[model samples]
Target: MAKEKPGDDKSPIAGTQSLDRALEMLITIAASPQPGMTLAACSAVLQHSKATTHRVLRTLVARDFLSYDDDLQVYSLGVANLRLGSEYLRRIDLRRVALPAMRELVAETRDTAHLATISGSDVIYIEVVDSPEPVRIFSRVGDAVPAFATAVGKAILAWTSADTLDERLPETLVARTANTITSRSLLIDNLALARERGFAVDNMENREGIRGCAAPIFDHNDTVIGAVSIAGPAAKVPEQNDSALGKSVVATAQAISALLGASPDAATALPR
Candidate 1:
């Protein structure tokens, strides 16, 4: 008989396996579309014994990472996690540094400007500077749009690594509008074009009456951290002036990136 291997056996890692399982349970709870998840539900999804799952969950509740309601018999993310997330966003430093530049961009173009970061398969707008024009476009600060269908999202995607893109983007793109790129090949081509031009454009791809242009913001490490965009009605964002608008947005994004300690050479190379 062959010697039994430790890998084949049920031996857990010394100090981290429990942490991993606890984190997975938290993720499962967070991912549920419903308001909360039951202990039995989490156990079923985790394929762990109910007793073990309960013990871990109680521990998480004790530490305030999750909240357990005795009356409802449900688990939800707790205030402690909210505190952690809020602190993480605070540390990003990008949002605080980009606001003035974004305001300037909006003032110059008389079009809405957005600062967004990629979250999973979507672009989450963290800041919005509204245009004063009566007919200008508007976007809420916390809203999300499909990453492949928006200029800001596409600008970041153009600078994303292949491995990260593979993990974040679905194989088949979802169509948001008639002009949205629905094929992987076409999206690849589109990103290539954006990379070459140093900015991205969305011509009624995300919505029928809107047009937008954006450029990626880089960090000190030369990593694409976020993007800045200018958006307006299709009539105002005419095809003839797209290049000029793209150049302006890229310049504004570069200015913001520089404030965040981005490399001077890298920032200057981005169509400024």
Candidate 2:
């Protein structure tokens, strides 16, 4: 006899085999490189008979989770999937989803990790994970800083639309510190670099003797919703270590984005 495969519904669970197969089918179709999957292609990928695959596909189509195109003989995700995704995104708490990763980032870097969102021309700190070291950066949860002078703000700004950027960015950027970029042209150049490197840095621009590295966080819709940042004294977060810390911040931001249902392609997409 042929050996039964995993998720074949022969185990202790009474009727999960069909459900497992259906979910797998949905994932396979969603991940397909083409716009949709032919019945034969679906069956081949699932390693199941055409009849069984057709039945599962029919059930999904009936439930509106998948759509079948007669002309193309293909199956693709339907409106129901979009509704489900929208509902899931509506209920997600950004700070709560990001706290664990922020904590982990602080542990690794020994610097304060902050979760912040854009509020007009300011960046508001919604959540913070403090460093464990004796002398570390301190930040209040509700503190707001100028979006033009901070790493987190620059990170988010790098991915914002041109129209939004024009609205958020002022005609004249006031210097918060001597290191802050006062020229609009220079700041724009800095944002461009941040977008290219996938992260941003503040070399004592936001506050004297403080430095930060940050990366933008994208949502399921590939929107720049917020940013994750690590900040500490300039002595500890030196320029040489910016690359390493930037990588950690980017990873943590990506993890939070995954939890928010962002697709793999979301990370690489630029502003619309």
Candidate 3:
């Protein structure tokens, strides 16, 4: 006889039990169309005894993670589940929809560009377009620095709720450079300015000797998706383009917005 594998018989059973116990019944009910499924259906999907499945689902209903409508006696997704899933889907969509626009920005700027979306206290870099310049700045996909510290980050934060802003950064600061804003009050004033101007400039706040300019990207829903930024050496970028660099950066972001079905306001907000 072959040697018995360690816990082989019991391991799979344990895993199945844990999953069955965890599936919220009310949620399952809410997810079903026509308001409910028969007891037989639940057993078929979970491959468990009807009694065990019913027990788990009833518990979920009691906790408000799910609900049972007696008259309809059918299940559908709960509002809470919808809300949670919606936020996730929104960001995923943001990434897909912004790609075309960021590509266009890169084409026009001839410098590196990025599409950034806010994540918690930081602005996450979702995509980047590399600089054609021989000596260039290279930022990979999915790299995020603090939003309070970068041009693109500030552009997105400027439109975010103030309460969310306070939670991410205090009035004091996390200094990344000697030029970093150490004063909370000053940063707050700058945020207000960004709100008024519809754009933000990093001015070497995050990295010394590097300058960055950014403008926010908006969706058809009027929600801010992220920002597009042009960053390079301060000496080279500003001197080479005069004010045209800033103008073009802003224009690129606006063009991205138009692609995403933004309002006509995008025309005026981001200009060449």
Give each model's whole-structure lDDT.
0.88, 0.92, 0.71
TM-score of each: 0.64, 0.89, 0.60
Model 2 alpha-carbon miss at residue 210, Å: 0.5
Candidate 1 regions with alpha-carbon error over 4 angstroms: 1-92, 267-272
Cα displacement (angstroms), candidate 2, residue 77, comes to 2.0
lDDT of 3 by residue, 1-272 (tens): 99888866644454586554545444455556675676667667667788887677666666555656677554444456667656655665666766676677667766778789888778888888787778767788989788888888888777766666777674457898887877878887887777676667887788888877888887766667789888877776674453576677777777777766677584334221
Task: Estimate, for each residue in 1-272, the C-alpha lDDT of model 2 and write its tens digit.
Answer: 98987868544466678998999999999988767999999999999999999999999999999999999899999899999988988999999999999999998998999999999999999999999999998899999999989999999898998899998887779898999999988888999999888999999999999999999898878898999999999999999999999999999999999999777667578774
Model 2, residue 257: C-alpha shift (Å): 1.6
Of candidate 2, the 10-residue stretch with the lowest lDDT total is 7-16
Candidate 3, poorest ten consecutive residues by summed lDDT: 263-272
lDDT of 1 at 247: 94
C-alpha RMSD by candidate, in order: 18.1, 5.1, 13.8
- Highest TM-score against the true fold, candidate: 2
Model 1 TM-score (2 dp)? 0.64
Error of 3 at 73 (Å): 39
Which runs in model 3 stand beyond 4 Å of their true positions? Answer: 1-92, 239-242, 266-272
